[model samples]
Structures are given as structure tokens and as C-alpha cells.
Target: MIIHGNRFTLRPDADAAQIEEALESLRNQGRVIPSVKSFVVGRDFGGEYEWGATFMIEDLQGYWEYLVHPAHRNTDQVGLPLVDKFASFDITDDPDPEMGAKIAALHQRRYDSDATLTQLVSDLGEYKGSAAPGAHGER
Candidate 1:
């Protein structure tokens, strides 16, 4: 299983409605995305980021499904612009030593296929993770 996590801080100008909408969209991802085995989206109590979410998937293929799903892309469109900082991580029990590279490749492929996604990520104040732009040899 792989546990994918994201944490983000909203821009100070973000209004309540936008925040709620983003949160609701995040919640909807777990419900609408079939590849998500389990998930949680909520406020970060003591973390540096304002909100966080975690998604559990059975394997790399499931993770790819989760990433490419329409619902997930919609969430990114709705939520990415409102956030000033964002970071993501993955913890997996898969035994393959190449799993990390494979995961990063999936993300890179997603970005390569969508110019809007690449721009959305570029607009962020900060983004960090193994699959982040420029990370793991990504341009």
C-alpha cells in the first residue's frame, strides 16, 4: 500500500467560501476517485501548513489512477490557485527499490500531458516533494 500525503497553506486573500469549496473538492476526491482505497482531508492542527490530506492506494497503478482521474484534476484546478504553499510525500510498503522513481515518473507524465497543471504548479509560492517540478531530475 502507498500512503500519499499533501499539506498546503492558503493565500491570505482567500475568502471563506473559496476555502470551503476547496476543502469540499478535496473531500469529494476520495468519494469520486475509485482508485483511492481510503483517504482523509482536514485541517492541520499543529503543522506549518493550514490543511492536509492523505490518500491510501493499493499500488502504483492505483496511484496513477488516482492522479489521472478527472476528479483529481478538477480538485487541482479549484484548489491549487488558492494555495501559497504546498508539499506532498509518499510512504509505501512496496518492496521495489525502483518504486520511488516509478512514482515520480507517473507524476511527471501527468504534468507533461497537461500544460495547465504545469502552470498551476509554477504559480505556487512553494512546492516540495519527490515529484515536485525540478525534483528527481524533472525540468
Candidate 2:
């Protein structure tokens, strides 16, 4: 499995509403693309990029297909112009048991005294069992 994402900073004069409309259109277009397993776009609350999109693909070929799809291409034509700069990455699933253990131990320490955080970790742990690779906390 592969996770692909892009982060974009909107142009100073870019219209937020119009950009959202364009993103929605792109999302609609993405739904029909065979290569895309799932896709999501959202605004960052407080991050380096103002807007971002994330999607999962089955493999490298699927990733290539998604990149060349007319809908995706069109979205780039319309949306790229509204951005000041952008960065993208494609991540493939590569798990390290040691890292996973360390992460779990860290979470345990951080959340052990907090009810909300404990519950969140418990929920994610339960969900991870049934989720796909790279989904939830699955390694």
C-alpha cells in the first residue's frame, strides 16, 4: 500500500470559497478513479501548509494512474494556479517492530494519567486491528 499527499500554501489573494469549490470538484472527480482507494482534502488548523490532500493507492502503478487521470490533471491546472507553493510525498508501508514498540510505550506513558488520551489510544488500538495497512495506528 502507498499513501500519497500534497501540501499547498494558498496565494495571498486566493479566494477561500472558490478554492474549496475547486477542491470539492476534484474530490468528486477522484471518486471514480479506479486507482484511488480513498481520498480526502482538508484545511490545516495550524500547520506549515494551509491546504492538503491525502489518498491511498494499491501500488506504484495505481499511483501513476492517479497522477495521469484527466480529473486529477484538471484539478492541477485549476488548483495549482491558486497556490503560492506546494510539496508532495508518497509513502510506502514499511514497518519496524522496534519503532512500533517504542511508539506504543511512549503513548502509554503520555496517556496513562489522562482519561481522554487513554480512551483515544484504546479506541485507536481497537480500530487498528480491523483497519488496512497505514490506516489508524497499524504499522
* lDDT winner: 1
Candidate 2: residue 52 lDDT (0-100): 76
Each prediction's RMSD over C-alphas, in Å, is 1.4, 14.8
Question: Candidate 2's residue-wise lDDT over 1-139, tens digit each?
Answer: 7677767677778787869866875686569779999988888657777777888887656765675577865675567567665655556674643543433343344334445433433432122221112323343
Model 1 steric clash pairs? none
Report the C-alpha lDDT of model 1 over 11-126, residue by residue, as the tens digit: 99999999999899999989988889889999888879999999999998899999999889888998999999898889999999998888888898888899999999999998
TM-score of each: 0.95, 0.62
**Backbone clash pairs in model 2 (N, Cα, C under 3 Å; residues 3+ apart or in different chains), count:** 0
lDDT score, residue 123, model 1? 96
